[model samples]
Target: MKSMKSVVPHLSFCVFLLCGNCLAAPPSPEALDACMRGWADQNLFSGTVLAAQDGQVLLHNAYGMADYNAPIANTCDTRFRIGSLTKGFTALAVLQLEEQGRLRTSDRLATVMPDYPHADTITLDMLLNHRSGIVDHTTLPDFQTVRRTSPCALARTIETFQSLPLDFTPGTQFKYSNSNYILLGHIIESVTRKPYADVIQRQILEPLGMHGTGFEYYRRPIPNMALDHTLENGSIRRAQDRVMQNAHASGALYSTAHDLYLWDRAFRTGRLVKEKMRQKILSCDAEYRYGWATTEMFDRKILAHSGETEGFCSTIIRFVDDDACLIVLSNLEGCSMGRIIQSLSALLFDRPYQLPKKAPTGPQASADYGAYVGRYQIKPGFFIDVTTQDGQLYRQATGQSRLQLHPESKDTFFVTEADARITFEYGGEGQVARLVLHQGNRDFPGDRL
Candidate 1:
């Protein structure tokens, strides 16, 4: 890898400390600070950043305001809702039980969650690996309203989803679903005869010395906790708090940068689980392994996860073999967390990444819009259909209502309904080959189908 001196002349002095390549020195603290400060100034990042290598802290800093209303500046100890990052911890608890011969990943869901719909067909492994085929009940109607207004019971939550059929055949494919971890949390309680919070605390949290992290309760008051805010239509507003039980082990937990750093060390060194179980958590046998998504970025094997609730977003990526990690927690909604982490990763590896820029406006006129009219399969169960009606172009997803695609550039389209942008790509023959959907700071690629 080369330095950014040539491409990004301004960041020539911002060299990063990294592993794998020894010719260059580790990224300086100044570099990380400068990178984060730049992002904070642009509203692209807030909350915290913790980066380390070989068990050494390289960067641990907080930026932006935890409560912009009072304008309390965030600190390293600021607690932010970790959202789905909690799944990795939940997965570890289950693996701990498995190591004790109390439960097996191969256990049939029916054996534990007898009342759950289609329990006979889904296995524990399916849930862990996100191949359970259960519909993510979170996306169902009234889920948001009900959760925001009341404390949701696990049993009641399960009942609401039980009437719904499986999303697909169990173990046949992968589609990440929070419903899986929620059920796993229930199963943990059944097997250990303890609350999910108690089980997780004893099994992982307390053991790892993570005192600043635990289950988040909607009704509870947490000291120094970051308030979640959403940026909408160019206005920032408070986001409603949802029931913790609604998210359960799937997305309800919260943590600070320091405590999460302790967790990373414990997880990476096998102090928390057996090497085999650790491998299952940190490496991929499928699109998702246990609780983490397996990915390759710049040819580096990385195990990572991202989380988003109403007013917050988070991501933790670990390059275990390279002894590196990036944990970002933000209390601001629609903050470009995806792009922030990607930029940080690029800096860590000396790759070229752009700074925040104004969104590209739509082209003055539409040309050959008909070329993008087709169905695209983003993944096994996800899709986007681009179609034209009369003289206008539109996009639709499986089981979703059609949305109009406002042309930005000739080959680019933006969706205002949920703040997404799509840029179509062409192949050698000059026809549409793929499209990348940019939303929530991450990119999803859909191929012509």
Candidate 2:
């Protein structure tokens, strides 16, 4: 069996079929205890879980504290900032406009916002698919510092990033830019002639009965809200410095698992989005949907999305066929919620097929390793350093200290820390020329220095 040979043994084709159909034998208490304890020891997770299959709630558990200072135990009702999951709502709002014949996906950006940079070349579909070459405003210099001091108005923020030249022409490739959805938010406002909050409420929340969902940054009082925390310089501190730049379509919205479960049910039953529109939303850009990042797992269509803000992190995963879903939310910056959810999916559906073992090709050619070592400018301000340590390649971001680069094959290395990865593009000189960082819907291009 591959399990005996490979470090990551690929599950056998037969095992894959059997495991997908395996009845929900609740994970043994002992196993769950060991896993949780191990994670706590390493501080890998400190949040909540809501898992369901076939519309049956399998498990709903909360961990850690809503207020770490007072150490108030978190409950299922505790609200956490759901970051970009708000994009799904934004996408739904645009689709609702489509339903009303107010907008079409094929509509050109110039028609909606004539003043928008490169409006003539970009399209609404590009906004939905994140193929629009608009530079992500969040990637601007001192964005985090600005976000900490005061909430940036949407127009100023969009203009700040819009001034930079586009990374590429529209409709060329995927680059997950928060600016895309933020623009959608602006479109929603422009078309409806109202604030984003009003449009979201009238279109999605009120209809779906998602009473708890809102874009209340400074207006609405957050109840049971988890303060964002981060471990920096070896001490854990509240991430109060990074301002919440009116996330609009990027990262705004506080929701509980219960409300999110309602959303899941609504999506499956075709309540929030019409059946045809839902299919379109789910099927469009199959590899990279409007708001959701997609992949085939265990031969089932898996739709997923993740969010990150100053101090909060969250992830949502759904299996379209079986309606299996998992949602994880945290109040800490840089939390690996996405990795945890993927691991959980592996546990539940028996995934991450273990590949057959092969002997390490000792001491890869120096030239081969040299091709991956270079600086990659992900956006303008963000850069990644791919270097080899102890023979394996590692990825290091500008502000982050840890180095994690997971091997995808031989030349490709996936960032184990975030939902981003780097693939070195070699030129004829046999040296790394361009490095592409693939972050769902967004791609970063960097030239070798």
Candidate 3:
């Protein structure tokens, strides 16, 4: 291993062959402050960043105000919607029930909910993996149509899908549908014979002493909570007010940076899920896993997830071996704040933290596009079909409808709706041999199939 500084102006490859070859360039405290301040000043990041390594805090800071109109500044204690990060908590509750013999991961959905139409084929593992083939009941046309003026209660939402068959066979593919977690929540309610809130309270919140975390709707007043915001035509507006309708399990939990840190600590050290179950939660799927998506950095395993809604964006990164984590929560949507936090964390750890390279636009290659237009294996038994329409790439896996992808480069494209991306790694054979799915700060290699 050798450390070679770039002597050439911009053309570069200062190769380092080993972990020790990478030197730590810890950002000075003052430099970090200036960096964050610059971000806020330019409206690049208006959120909180907390990073810890080797059980020591390198940086923990909040920028801007909790509410733009009010003078109250954002602080480490200000709560923000954790969004899909809520799924991790729900997964833990299910594991707890499993430990109690209330259920098993192999239990069929039909056993739990006799009325669920496709329950006969859907298993607990299917639900956790989002492969139940159950329709994203939340996205049915009638959902947004009839749901416009009337808000259905959680139980009613679950009941609406009782007669609907699955979209495909269970455990055959990966599709990110909120319907799975919502059903998981219903299972929790059914088994405990208690409200979802109470179950979460006893199993996770109370046990973790996360006194400041809970599910709250848009209109409710959350103490020390930051109001979600969105950049609208160059102005920042409070943005967390849209009705969640029946999406609680999908994205409605809120918590402060500190509570999330506690949750992360519990997760990494197995204070929550047992060791084996923790591995399941962090494993990657054909697309994603039970809760977190496993990734690799310098060959080290990493588990990560991100949450987003109308006005909030949140991300959690856990270094499996290091017992370290990074949690970033923002009130604004469509900002580079999350990437900035990731870069900062990578900088602190002396890890590669480059931002998603901006996508080349307007034109695309003929052979380049065609080579990537086939299915590739991301995880065992799963694949992503790369297709192009009018030169834009769209990714569709088994049991999922195609969704357009935003290109970061010819070889790399990211799904803007969530923190997921695909990168093509060329082989010595002069062919696109492998594709890497980058999510939650971890990269999963997908060989061409």
Per-prediction CA RMSD (Å): 8.9, 9.8, 10.9
Better of 1 and 3 by lDDT: 1
Candidate 1 lDDT, 113-223, residue by residue in tens: 787678888899999888888877777776755754578888777777777878899999987777788789899999999999999899988888898898887678988
Over 4 Å off, model 3:
1-24, 27-32, 145-150, 160-165, 282-287, 351-449
lDDT of all predictions, in order shown? 0.76, 0.68, 0.69
Q: Sort by lDDT, best first.
A: 1, 3, 2
lDDT of 1: 0.76
Cα lDDT for residue 439, model 1? 66
Candidate 3 local lDDT, residue 353: 39
Q: Candidate 2 on 1-449: residue-level lDDT in tens?
A: 00000100111111322234333333433433344444444444567777778888766777766777887877888888887788888887888899889989889999999987799999998988888888876666656556435677888777777778888899998777878887888898899899888888887778778766667575556777777676432235576544443776666677887778888888889886678888886766446666677765567777777776667777777888878887777776655554455446656664442111122335533445756777777667888777876666667777775545555665566643344556778789866788877664356688766
Instruction: Return the lDDT, model 1, position 373.
Output: 85
Best candidate, TM-score: 1
Stretches of candidate 2 exceeding 4 Å from the true structure: 1-38, 232-235, 350-398, 402-449
- Clashing residue pairs in candidate 3, if any? 295-442, 296-443
Q: Evaluate residue 37 in candidate 2 and report its C-alpha lDDT on the 0 to 100 scale.
A: 40
